[model samples]
Target: MKKIDNMTVTQIKEYVVTRQKEEYPNLIPMLKEDHRAAVKKIGQNLEKKTAARDQEVQRIEKMKSIESGYYDQGILNIGGIDEVGRGPLAGPVVTCVIILKPDSSRLYVNDSKKVAKKNRETLCEQLLEDAVDYAIGQVDCDVIDNLNILNATKKAMTDSLAKLSIKPDLLLIDALHIDTDIPQKAIVHGDATSYAIAAASIVAKVYRDNLMQIYHEEYPEYGFDHNMGYGTAEHIKALKKYGPTPIHRKSFIQNLGLK
Candidate 1:
């Protein structure tokens, strides 16, 4: 085998990329004491990346434990209920009810707020595709203005639950109780603690963000693509300068003094 000292920098990088922890033992012996700086830097990065991945796996297992407790109780179909856009100044409140298979091993699943925007879309697709049953419900700004955000959010969650083809034995909801005869446990920060609720949060966040992106095409002044109708400085500035769009929640902006 060629020594790392004799290998080109490009070759060293390739080796680092392709190598795994099992090969790390061999790597140490191959490195020369004085000239191992480049290899050491790259190896450190690889180690850090591996460590982060392992940490995420452990966290996912902890989150999955919530569902496992239900599975232990003979509840096969457990649904996760979560909603997005409740605090946004505009756009609709979107909710998702999703039932994932008990044996799901998707490491990327986590609280939607913890995920980057691009990764959320990819994870959303993966979650939907792998789910045993999933459904989305959206309540527009008009309904929010009429019914109030909390009641409208509950409405959206219940609507999504109703749309699911396979009714769940139990619901793990994030913070709010839905008006449903079906059994549910309203968990504070369920999106961070429960795997099922986190999956639903991701789906709901992505779906609402997409809708806001579409709305951005019509109202580019508000920067909906990035802010997702949230009350950001830019959005508020736009609301003051350009006035409210049709999608703006009248009740939400009434205090803002935007007509």
Candidate 2:
């Protein structure tokens, strides 16, 4: 092995990358005092990253604990329900029912609003792949305008549950009760507190975001790719200039005075 004093900085970095996690602490000690500063900076950065990752893992475990007592009682298929696009002025409200395996990775799971878009997309893919059972339902803007957003959201949620391949023994839903026979607990901001609900929220957000991207191609003036059909200034400007599309929720947009 080359002595630390003889190794170039690039070589030392390569050595650090190859070292096992347990070997990191001892690595700095092996370096000469003159060579230690740059290497020490690298070690500090690694330590900080590890600490952040560990903290997130602990949070995920805490969130999963909500299902532990139920699992102990033999309720194995616990689906979480959540929806996206309820507030959007156009496009469909999308709901997801997801039964995440107890052992599925929960790192970075949280309310969809709290996650970055790129991370949400990545987590959505992971959750879908890792889920034991999952389904999605969509209600178009026409239904949202007629039934009203709250009732439309409930219908979408119920539809998602109906489409699940495996019937859930119980449901943990985010802040709304669906019209279903299954036993359920409505948790306010559940996506932020429950692992399963957060997973559902992430999946629903990504699914709706992708839909909006497609809508953007059809209606480039509305900027759906970025606004996701929300009534942003750009969207409102487009509404005033060009009028509502088939996807616009007429009931919600009446206040905007768009003819």
Candidate 3:
């Protein structure tokens, strides 16, 4: 019988549920609609905060997974490896290896595909500043042609691990396991599912985007700045008109009759 204004949010919620089940049984439809609308309004105010907290929890859980592995072996070095530019037509495959602190709080770290370019850039900068160690390795067009994309991707990953300032006891790779003596796990769709892999994905993507932006200045006709070396209609038309640049992967162009 107490007024709604006198009740706490939780009390009000319980009251609403109880009323729906007991006093409002005859008005179930209207009561249910009102309850839903009130719950939605409360959720609207809390959704952003709730999402951030959830992301933090997910990040911590991911870190704990890696930490558990390290703790079992009593070793601290753990690395995450990911690659970008695999599907692009006119750029090198770039891979990044990142050794993060077990308790790093790098914000806005998520799958590169899920983040905007500006956010990725900001995260990349913050990651570089906060990471224990990180390295980038690139395999160019000629190497990609000779070794093929799979092997080239592996090589890029290996090279990135090699360039790391500190050696890792555990390697978390995105999908492809490199041929290495290092202890490694290949996680499918890791960029979306694994925090470490997502961080590495962001690093690799930002690095390759910058590289392609530089290439754009040299080959303005291909629209590398806009498309980032992808096979967009503009890029393909430019290839037909002016032919492939030195940076174009020859193997990819074979299907396009540009060889």
Candidate 4:
């Protein structure tokens, strides 16, 4: 009913913020075209925000189910284990163990391979700050070559578990078995299915990716920065052109017939 056109920019914003949804239809007709568009957009944006918040709540609830499934019998110190770089022709196989709090639930946390690099880094930081306890270990190219990738990954995971300040009562492993005295469950694709495993994957991936970025400075020919030591076509070409660096896993390269 009033001349909204006469209102200042700040007044219009204030009015939009304060106005209820039911009042929008009446107020929209009185406003100019730009203001009307802004009103509709604001309503839509609000709806989207509400939907996203609800989805996040559901995700959090789903993650909590894993917590109850395994640790409901009063086992609070459950560690999730994961490793990265088994397929890489260069760099070490890094592993991480994360012990999340009993009441912890991070909806943003997911399988490291599923998350963006920047977001993975952010989540890794959050895990370090929030986890009850955490540790990382790496099996270098020398060790990987000596024991093979599978054994090397197991060793790295076990080493990570050993380093945890509060030793875990139960372990949730992301696919492979670790040689540890502690109890563990090897869940296929556990990183995607279990919240704790996902946290460990994020931590290990970010940590290992940083190591590859550093290696990029020394081995610029392999594009380690982008591939994170994975054996891509460019990397294979570089291997042929430049030959193997000290970090290159000899056993892995042997398969490429690039001796």
Model 2 C-alpha lDDT per residue in residues 18-111, reported as the tens digit of each score: 8776665566456524356886676567677667877998998888888877888888899989999989889999999999777786589999
State the local distance difference test value for candidate 2: 0.87
Per-candidate local distance difference test: 0.88, 0.87, 0.80, 0.83
Ranking by lDDT: 1, 2, 4, 3
Winner by lDDT: 1
**Ten-residue segment with the worst summed lDDT in candidate 3?**
20-29
Best by TM-score: 2
How do the predictions measure up, each by TM-score? 0.89, 0.93, 0.78, 0.85
Better of 1 and 4 by lDDT: 1
- Pairs that clash in candidate 1: none
- Clash pairs for candidate 2: none
Please give the TM-score that candidate 1 achieves against the real structure: 0.89
Clash counts per candidate, in order, are: 0, 0, 0, 0
Model 1 accuracy (lDDT, Cα): 0.88
lDDT of 4 by residue, 1-259 (tens): 4557676656777777777655656665455354567654554655565568669778767865777776678888999899888888899999999998877776678888889888898888877777999999899999998999999999999888778889899998988876788888888988888888889999999989988999999889899999888889999999999999999999989988865
Please give the distance, in angstroms, between residue 200's alpha carbon in candidate 2 and its true position after superposition.
Answer: 0.3
Which residues of candidate 1, in runs, are more than 4 Å off? 1-9, 20-35
Q: lDDT of candidate 3?
A: 0.80
Report lDDT (Cα) of residue 66, candidate 1.
83
